[model samples]
Target: MSALAERWRAARPKVAGLHLDSGACSRPSFAVIDAVAQHMRHEAEVGGYVAAAAAAPALDAGKSAVAALTGMTADDVIYTTGSNHSLDLLLSSWTGPRTVACVPGEYGPNLALMAANGFDVRALPADGSGRLLVDATAAMLAADPPAIVHLTALASHRGIAQPARELAETCRGLDVPLVIDAAQALGHLDCAVGADAVYSSSRKWLAGPRGVGMLAIRPALAQRLRPRLPPADWNLPMTVLQRLEHGETSLAAQVGLSVALGEYLAAGAETMRAALAAVGKLTREALADVDGWRVVEPVGEPTAITTLAPTNGADPQRVRDWLVAERGIVTTHAEVQRAPFELAAPVLRLTPHVDTSAEDLATFRDALADATEEV
Candidate 1:
């Protein structure tokens, strides 16, 4: 293992078996766990408000870390329960026409959220694989600009990464506000694109605790949002982004997320990204000749997510369950509901992090073959 992978695996000692499900949730480091425990302990001794007050600086640092990752200022970021909540807050706060242009394969929940918010959701031009065609998208935006341009930087169901930076540039040229769902890309891929708003959960690539997410809005967009108002009697001074945040939140989770971000920075972001990409390539290559299943992504797709489809109409969930129960290998089954507009059938999603080894891939391949035979 690489030194960084070694340290990552060491910090996550509970992962006794091969773990290939970082797309769903990563293994939290000891530092993150301790931070949560320490904050909870402090809350037990003191009061919740008091413990939160003491953690203000750490929380601020966490915001700064998020800003650093997303190319925004700390003042532009706000904490939320998770990505869904973050997107809801933004959508609810919108004061303009309810129209959104996004990829056809956008996350199903996001599509539902747009519908609930009464938005006319339109599909951006993309190839058959669901990757945005940059020139075509630019032409489409210029011809009929939507109120908002939303892009999921990386998808949940597949490994094909959208051209977020290219689309961001086009949206900027057209003066259209672009919202990015970086749930699968924040720590795994570079998220420093010039989108007007970016949001993600902390648990996936950052290896933070669950129940914590963040949203960062550019100053121009932040000023335009009509977020919920505080009570008239409570004369609390707050920034526009801060006003969007709920009054009560879990300080323990915030502290854990901060420690996790700190660890990612300390480990070197570029180093981690490269390691993940390498492992993804390794996985695709190793599983190329595995029988009864085929890799869904192109061998050269620069993403840590990989998907496989059974050739013989086998249930992916059964294979996933068998792998875990019999082989101690963890993975996720991506249903068509995750991207109902694009996916034809369910797929087996494998997302290995930097800690994944070649030996792990080999083991997974052999185990998957066995699973295919049995299932």
Candidate 2:
């Protein structure tokens, strides 16, 4: 077997099921799980503050791992509870009257956050395919530039990878701040789009423990952001990175995320992405012959997420449950609320990871086919 395949196989024992839900949450390697336990043990023995001091290097390494993936300096990485928390910190810290431009299929929670913060949210003009029209977006920026131009590098519910790099360049030309929500793209796809800021959770493609996410901002942009609240400790560093991270955090989860990032990097980004993409394509082809099923893809090239829906009026959640209960296959049901503008009905989001094998994918297709007939 290929080295990458071998590594994936080695990691398989860590997962309890045929996990095809990397888009939602991936199974972390045993090493990552152990790291978390080890940190917790140390904290219990040495006291929380002392243990944190001892783990300073590993904690710093976690930031470096995120920086390595996103092309940012380690100092620019800010740890958060999750993607939504990171975004809330970012938006809440903005001092100016807020105005933001984004795609119609922007993440549901993000839209709500903007509305709650009283920011004027504008949907950028796009082609029928939902990719932002570069010229039109640039025109809008020139006519009345929003305080920030936000883009989700990839949507969770669909297969289209947004044109974030092009939009980033456009925003850069206009000197507008570009914030990229890479919750779905950080570890699954190439994320070095050169946006002013990028943020994502560790639970998804990174396969880290939940409740820990990282945000990276350009040093220049970081300098401009004011802290959301006054510092509780004047002795602590007051850089923009430090400003976003307030209150106590899960040190063990941070260590787990660091180890997870190491595992992903050691496997090599291109190798892992290619492996995942292959499995995703294999799944799509496998299910193509299945009746009453349609693989959803937009104008852009698809990433690792293969969104499928039944045309026979079968409920998507029911289909997901059937797969889990009868077939021992795990999948995610993408709801309309997740992508309010893009999805009219729910879809079965099958995300094949680096560890999935041909046999497993074939079984998934066959089981799905059988389930479609019965339900």
Number of the top TM-score candidate = 1
Q: lDDT per residue, candidate 2, 215-318, as tens digits? A: 89998787777775665355555666766785577989988999989888888888787776776677777776677878876313547788887788877888
Q: What is the lDDT of residue 202 in candidate 1?
A: 94
Model 1 Cα lDDT, one tens digit per residue, 1-375 = 888888889897667677999999999988899999999999999989999999999999999999999999998898999999999999988989999999999999999899988999999999988999999999999999999999999999998888999999999999999999999999988899899999999999999999999999999998888776764247577667767897677889999999999999999888888888888898899998788888988888888999998888889999999999998899999999999899999999999988888988988988998998898
Model 1: clashing residue pairs? Answer: none
After superposition, the stretches of candidate 2 with alpha carbons farther than 4 Å from their true spots are: 12-14, 231-237, 298-302
Superposed by TM-score, candidate 1 places the C-alpha of residue 109 at a distance from the truth, in angstroms, of 0.7
